[model samples]
Target: MFDILVIGSINADLVFISDIRPKAGETVMGKDFKVLPGGKGANQAIAAARLGKKVGFIGCVGNDDNGKKLIENLRGNNVETQYIQIVDDVPTGVANIVVAEEDNSIIVIPGANYSISKDMIDKNMDILLNSKLILLQNEIPMEVIEHIIDLCFGKDIKVILNPAPAVKLKESIVNKIDYLTPNEHECKIAFGNPNTDGLLTKYPNKLIVTVGDKGVLYHDGNKKVNIPAFKVDVVDTTGAGDSFNGAFAVAIVEGNSLYESLLFANKAAAISVTKIGAQEGMPYLEDLKGL
Candidate 1:
C-alpha cells in the first residue's frame, strides 16, 4: 500500500512573475513568465514521492496535451498516477498565477477538475482504503471530499485536510477531519482570530494554522503547540504549505512525534520557498536528514 494518497486538483500553472502587482485595467511590462506542472494534489504527491514515500494521486485531467504532459511528469517523479481519471469533454485545469515581489494571486479555471467526484473515488476504493494517509484540499468539490472522509471515517486511514485558496466549508467536514491544515487567513475565516485567548480550550481537536515564516500553531486535544519555521531565503512562496502537509504526513507515517514532524515539515517548506517551481522546490529525505 502507498504511504500517502492525495485527492485534489491537478493543473498546469502558467506563472507570470513581476516586481509589483498590477492594479485593475492597468498593464505593465512583466519580468518573467513560465509554465510548470502544478496543482495541490500533484505538488503534494511529488513532494512525498521525492522524499521516498510511496505516493498515489487521484484527480481528473482533461483529454488534452497539458493533461497528458502532467501525467507523464508524475510518472517520471515516481508517483503512481493510475487512479487519475481522464475526462473527455472538459479541458485540463489551468491556474494563472501572478507572482509579485511581495505576494501572489491566482485565478483557476477548474475545467476537468470540477468533474472529479465521489463516483471516481468509489472506483479507486481499494487504493483509498489501504493508504496510511489521505491528503485532501478544497480544490475538489467539498461534497466529494466529504464522501471520501465518510468512507474512511471509521477505517485506519488518517485524513489530512489542507484548506487553501480558503473558502467556506460545511460543519460535517469540520467535525470529522483528523487534522485540518489552514493558512493564517483560512484560520481566521474558519475559526476566529488566532490571537484569541484560550483558543486551545475551545473545540480543540481540529485545526493547525500554518503561519508562513512565523511557523505553525496547533490546538491539540489538551494543549496548544507552537512550531517555529526555519529561516531560509524565499524565492517563491507558492506551494510551500502543500509541501508542509506532504512532509507532515510522511513524517507521521514514519512514526515521528508531532513536534518532530512539524519541524521536519517546516524545513521542507522553508527549502521549497527558496526555489521557484512547486514540485521542483521540494527537498528530499537526505536533505531533511541534514536539516
Candidate 2:
C-alpha cells in the first residue's frame, strides 16, 4: 500500500523571472526563463518521495515530449507513476509562472489535467483505497475531486485538500476531508469568510492555513496554535505550499503530533523557497537534518 497517493494535476511550469509584473496590454523584459516539471500533484508527490515516503500519483498527461519528460522526472524523484495516464489528443498541462519580487504569479492551461474525470477515479478505486493518505488540489475537475472525497468517506484513508486556484467547497465536502490546507486567500474563498481565526476554531485540527513567511496556523481543539516558519534566504516561492502539504502528510502518517507535523511542514516549505524552481527546490530528508 502507498503511504500517500496524490490525485491531482501534472504540468510543465514555464517560469519567467522579471523585475515587475506588467499591466494588461503592456510588455516587459524578463531576466530569466526556465521550463520545470510541476503540478500540485506531482510536486507534492515528489515532496513526499524526497522525504522517504512511498508515494504514488494518479493523474493524466498528454502523449508528447513534455508528458514523457514529466513521467521520467517523477520516476527520477522516486514517485510511483504507474497510474498516470497519457492521452492522445490534448497537450500536457502547463503553468505560465512569472517570478517577480521573490513571489510568483501563475496562469494555468489545464489541458490533460481536465481530462481527469469521475470515470478515471472509478477505474482507479483500488489504488485510491490502498493509500494510507490522499492529497488533492483544485487543478483537476471539481467533480472528480468531490467523487474521491466522497469515496473515502467513513473509510480508513485520510484526505488532505489543498484548495489552490481556490473554489467554493460545499459544507458536505468540508465535513468529509480530514485536513484542509488552504492559503489565506483560499481559506476566505472556500468558506466564504474573511475571519480566518473564527474558521480555524470552527474546524479545530481539521483546518490548517499557511500564511507565507509568517508560518502556519491551526486550532487544536482547546486553543489556537501558530507554527512559525523557519528563516531562510528566499528565492522562488513556487510550490512552497505543495511542499508543506507533502511533508505534512509524511509527518502525520509517521505518527507525529499535530504540532510536530506542522513544524516539519513549515521547515519543508521554508527550504523550498530557498531555491529557484518548484520541484527543483523541494527538499530531501538529508536537507532537513541541519535545520
Candidate 3:
C-alpha cells in the first residue's frame, strides 16, 4: 500500500530563460535553457516522496529517451514508477516554458498524456484503492479523472484535485472531490465565477485557493482564514504550486489540522522557489526543520 497515489501526466520540461519575449514571428536570444523532468503528476509525486511519504505514480510516457529518463528520475527521487506506462507510437508529453521578466508562459504538447485511458485505471484499481490519498490534476483526461473519483466514492479514500490548466467541472464531480485546490485564476475558471470569496465560502474547507505571494485562502467552516506565505527571495516560480499541493497531501495524511497543513505546505512552497528546478528545488523532510 502506498501513502500517496498520483494519477496524472508526466513530462519533460523544456525551459528557456530569456531577457525579453519576442513579438510574433520574431526570435530572441536566451540566457539559459535546460531539459528537466516535470508534469503535475511527476512533480507532485517527487515532492511528496521528498517530504518523507511513499508515493506511487501512474501515467503514460512515450517509448523514448525522455520517457526512460523521466521514469529513472522518479525512481531516483524515491517515487514508485511501476505503474507508469511506456506507449509505443506516441511521443512523450513536453512543456515549453519561457521565463522572462519574472513571469513565465507555457505551451504543452500532451502527446502520450492524452493516451491515459479508463482501461489503465481499471487495471490499477487495487493500487488506487489501497493508497491513503490520491492526487489528480487537469493534465490527464477529464473522463478518466471523473471515473477515478466515482470509483473512490464511499471507499473512505481521500482525493485532492488540483484543477490546473483549468476547465469548468460538473457540480456532481466537484461535490465528490474531498479537496479542491486551485490557484486564484484557476478557481475563477473552474467555478465560472469572479466572486472568489463567495466560492470559498460556498465550499468552506473543501476549496483551498493558493494566491501567490499573498499566501493561501480557505473558509474554515466558520470563517475565512488566510495563511500568510513565508517571506523569501523567489528565484523561479515554476512548480511552486505543485510543491504546495504535494506537501499539503502529506500533511493531511499525517493527520495535521487544516490550518497546520496549510502552514506546512506554505513553508514547502516557499522553500521550492528558492532554487531553480522544479523537482530539484523541492525540500526534503530535514530541510523543513529550520523553517
Candidate 4:
C-alpha cells in the first residue's frame, strides 16, 4: 500500500530566468531557460518519493513526448505511476514560468489535466482507498476533488488539501478535510481576506498557513504553533510549498506529531528554495539529516 496518493495535475514546466519581470506588451532578455517536470501533484509525489515514502500519483497527461518524459521522471524519482493515464489527442499540461529575483509568475495551460474525469477516479477507487493519505491541489477539476473528499470522509484514510491557485470551496467540503495547507495568498482567497484568525477558530488544528520565509502557522487544538522557516539563501522559490506539503505528508504518515512534522516540512521547503529549479531543488531524505 502507498503511504500517500496524490490526485492532481502533471505538467511540464517551461521556465525563463530573468533579472526583472517585463511590463505589459514589453520584452526583456532572460538569463537562461530550462524545461522541468512539475505539476503540484507530480512535484509533491516526487518530493515524497525522494524522501523515501511509498508514494503513488494519479493524474492525466497527453500521449506525447512531454507525457512520456513526465512519467519517466516520476518513475525515476520512485513514484508509482500506474494510476497516471494518457489522454488521446490532447497535449500534456504545461506551465510557462518566469523567475525574476528568486520569485516567479506562472501561466498554466491545463491541457490534459482537465481530462482527469470522475470515471477515471472511480476506476482507481481501489488505489485511492488503499492509500494511507490523499494529497490534493487545485490544479485539477474541483468536482473530482470534491468527489474524492467525499470518498475519504469518515473513512480510515486521511486527507490533506492544499488550496493553491486558490478557489472558493464549500464549508461542507472544507469541514471534511483532515488538514488544509494554504499559503498566505491562498488563505486570503479562501476566506475573503488574508487573515487566518477566523479560519483558525473555524478549522482549529486543521488549518495550516504557510508564510514565505517567515515560516508556518497553524492551530493545534489547544494553541497555535508557529514553526520558523530554516534560514537559507534562496535561489528560487517555485517549489518551496510543494516540498513542504510532500515532506509534511511523509512526516505525518510516519507518525510525527504536528509540531515535529511542521519542523521537518519547514526544513525541506527551506532547502528547496536554495536551488534554481522546481523539482531539481527538492531535497532527498539524506539532505534533511543535518538541517
RMSD for all candidates, in order, please: 1.7, 0.8, 1.0, 1.0
Of the candidates shown, which would achieve the greatest TM-score relative to the real structure?
Answer: 2
- Candidate 3 lDDT over 119-167, as tens digits, reads 9999999999999999999999999999999999889799999998899
Query: How far off is residue 291 in model 4, in Å?
Result: 1.9
Higher-ranked by lDDT: 2 or 4: 2
Q: Model 3: number of clashes?
A: 0
Give the alpha carbon lDDT tens digit for every residue of 1-291 in model 1. 889999998999999999888899999888999999989888988888888899999999999999999999999999999888899999999999998875678898888888998888999999999999999988889889889989988788989899876776666777777788888788666664555325444546457778878898876676787888888777888889889989988988898877788888898998888888787788888876655
Q: In terms of TM-score, which candidate is stronger, 1 or 2?
A: 2
TM-score of each: 0.94, 0.98, 0.98, 0.98
**Residue-level lDDT tens digits of model 4 in 115-155:** 99889999999999999999999999999999999998998
Candidate 3 lDDT (Cα, whole model)? 0.93
For residues 1-291, could you state the per-residue lDDT of candidate 2 as single tens digits?
Answer: 899999999999999999998889999999999999999999999999999999999999999999999999999999999999999999999999999987999999999999999999999999899899999999999999999999999999999999998999999999999999999999999999999999999999999999998999999999989889899999999999999999999999998998999999999999999998999999999899878
Model 4, runs deviating above 4 Å: none
- Alpha carbon lDDT of each predicted model: 0.85, 0.95, 0.93, 0.91
- Candidate 1 has an lDDT of 0.85
* Weakest lDDT window of 10 consecutive positions for candidate 1: 192-201
Q: How does model 4 score by TM-score?
A: 0.98
